[model samples]
Target: MYSAEIILEQRTRALSEINLNGFGQRHQGKVRDFYSLPGNRRLLVTTDRQSAFDRILGQIPFKGQVLNQLSQFWFEQSSDILPNHMLSVPDPNVMLAREAQMFPVEIVVRGYMTGVTDTSIWTMYQKGSRQMYGYNFKDGMYKNQPLATPIITPTTHAELGGHDKPLSRTEIIESGLVAEEIYTQIEEKALALFARGQELCGKGGLILVDTKYEFGLIDGQVAITDEVHTPDSSRFWIASTYESRLGQGQEPENFDKELLRLWMRSKGFGGDGAPPALDEDIIARLSQRYIGCYERITGREFESDLTQPVAERIKANLEGLAL
Candidate 1:
């Protein structure tokens, strides 16, 4: 059990010694590369690669830093809500997190209906269907409609090229992956975190619309793992215009992947094929959006030296790791 500071030191050392040819490549997700570390812990590195609609687009400068810092901000803020697997942040794009058996489900909670998935929900409503993946939905709902209360919709984590399927609580329990008591604990903690997130965002003049959460078992206890309320895991809407946008049937101004999704859709590219290259202007605008998200959410200016070379910065941070 390394303290956060020690873990950060170790990560810096490891980065200094990172073999470009053999960093013990463990697994590669859409935008992250996982490297094995001592014990069961793994080093998660956020690369510059950008992915939308499940397809990897060209790399965007500093995109990885934005994600890493965003996750770090949320982890620090929400530690009081529940224990997270965060051990330390080794570098701007690297995290030392606890190794746990990841529960196969992605827990999604929605406060307001919006976006493509929400549209899918409405389509199900119009067909008089009360359920999606066995979860019931009431009929005749309009867009951006508020739920009587927030609902938890769980979906199974899928492999590459595979689609995640929704699962009922009952199914999750019967699968024997987790005990009913533990599953209940996950539910309680997730909602509590979301509530806190809502409160914090409200103060920031933002609305936490919806988000996905992942959990893993640490020493037989379920804990929040991976990233928390970052822009990647959650949607943030400008608070002031939320009501006006809903009344006018306009989408709320948001800070999240929605903008990238819109760009992809405009080019008639879905997730299945290669994505079009984003122009420099669009890239610059998106970069600013990420920076803005950090400042607005944390109420602190982002003071990163983006002009420095990533590899050099990483090498300096890892100086202590050299044996």
Candidate 2:
């Protein structure tokens, strides 16, 4: 575990974008930069740039490496449940993956009713909304309360700088976005993946509160694509304090990006004109939280090389792979 003081002293930077020669077209997402490779493969580079409310929130130190390594860990751990896009981890901040026909929906699985976003179920419920994405919630449920069972609430995949609207299962098929048969398969896979996440986090004394999964068609089969169970894609709370916190009307201690989101909310930024610039202290704390998430979830020490530049290290590793 890295002490807060040590993490601040290291003070590494968020990686800048890179261009690899001989790679095909490049596609950049909120946090990942994707480049097409030969043989239907793609090179995905996770950058340190932080994004929330569907907007870029500057850079958090070592953010890219933490997300990439954590996603790589989950991809390897959960491959048996479903075939994923990952082919190999060429570097600490890079993953070479197979390109797939991406599904236009984000499969969000929720086991709790807490979040700071406008689209959060708790926000909607608190505003007197009983129905959400075809799931009905009964009255008298407290904030951050666990559900009877995990629910799959999907949303349309939005373009960059766009908001993702909530989508019901029926809307997905009725709108001709996904065929009924394929949607059924996606639902099954999403729930199974969530179960796997919950089981793993449970052993680590954490709760996989909710997570979003992306899927794509690979060789006529739906395969998991994008990051899975990372702090960026999921919400995790310390299990030991969950019950007491909820009872005391206190927020649970989270290891995910929710902490940053909360801080931004305090600054009155919410998918608006411009986000507030984060300071070095906030950056250091966020970096430690990310590293904390990695250690607690994977049960491994996060090996961050502050002495070496991240771009150079990734380039060297990729060259070694001869890709």
Which 10 residues in a row give candidate 2 its minimum summed lDDT?
Answer: 5-14
Relative to the true structure, how large is the alpha-carbon lDDT of every model?
A: 0.72, 0.85
TM-score of 2: 0.94
Per-candidate TM-scores read 0.87, 0.94
Candidate 2: stretches off by over 4 Å: 3-13, 268-271
User: RMSD for each model, in Å, please?
Assistant: 6.6, 1.7
Winning model by lDDT: 2
Mind giving the per-residue lDDT tens digits that candidate 2 earns over 5-63? 66666555447676776676678888888888779988999988887777776767677
Prediction-by-prediction clash tally: 3, 0
Tens digit per residue, CA lDDT, model 1, 52-151: 7777666555567778887888788888777777888878877877788898889887786554753245555655667764566665677777777776
Pairs in steric clash, model 2: none
